[model samples]
Target: MAYLYYGADARPAEIPDHVLAHVKVVAATKLRRGESFMLTWRHRGEGTGGRTSLWMQPSIPLRFVFDEPEPEALDSEYLRKLANEATSSRGIVLEWDDEAIVGHPGEAPPIDAMAA
Candidate 1:
């Protein structure tokens, strides 16, 4: 599992490593362009239901921690999908099933160093 630590409070949003990889790409791209938007994701935890959304800004603190030591190749189709959503009024939404974004562990090669 991967954890996205957001804000000064360090509120942790649990995301699968594969899905987080995609989110990281979108988040980094937006933040680099000085864009602020909302990131919403559905909860996958046992007792947790519904979803969560955050106002993502360049000024705020955000960290993406992955259990995997190395990065995985990114999915271009998924990346395009996320980028389009991010520019929309609805902003970006991360689905739990998007974990299929990357191949498992050694099954794939590493992505860009920036994504690491």
Candidate 2:
């Protein structure tokens, strides 16, 4: 699993590839536009049993990791669907921690940004 963080904060986990693509696009767009927002995710578990986490940070200064590096761009329609979902609901989000995180896990942890 991979973890996606906004700025220096953890967002979501176990995120689907498609949704992750959308999130990247959205986050990139926001960064390009000089905007930022809160990002959150379920770092562990599934559904009601999940333990959620959040982080607050800028949109552009983000890091993405995988078993392999992800492509820069993704399908537009799929990304649009994710954006729609985010707009419709809270979407997969992150919980904020007062302490700052400046790096990602060296190994792939069972925590993906979009999988949740």
For model 2, residues 39-97, the per-residue Cα lDDT tens digits are 55544444555555333235345665543475533444444444454444355353323
Off by over 4 Å in 2: 6-14, 46-48, 51-61, 70-73, 84-116
**Could you say which candidate leads in lDDT?**
1
Structural similarity to truth (TM-score) of each candidate? 0.81, 0.47
Q: Per-residue alpha-carbon lDDT of model 1 for 1-116, expressed as tens digits?
A: 89999987756888888778878988898998899888987777579789888999999989999999988567666666777878888988876454453222223444452322
- Judging by TM-score against the true structure, name the best candidate: 1
lDDT of 2 at 90: 58
Instruction: Assess candidate 1 and give its lDDT.
Output: 0.76
- Runs in model 1 with CA error above 4 Å? 98-116
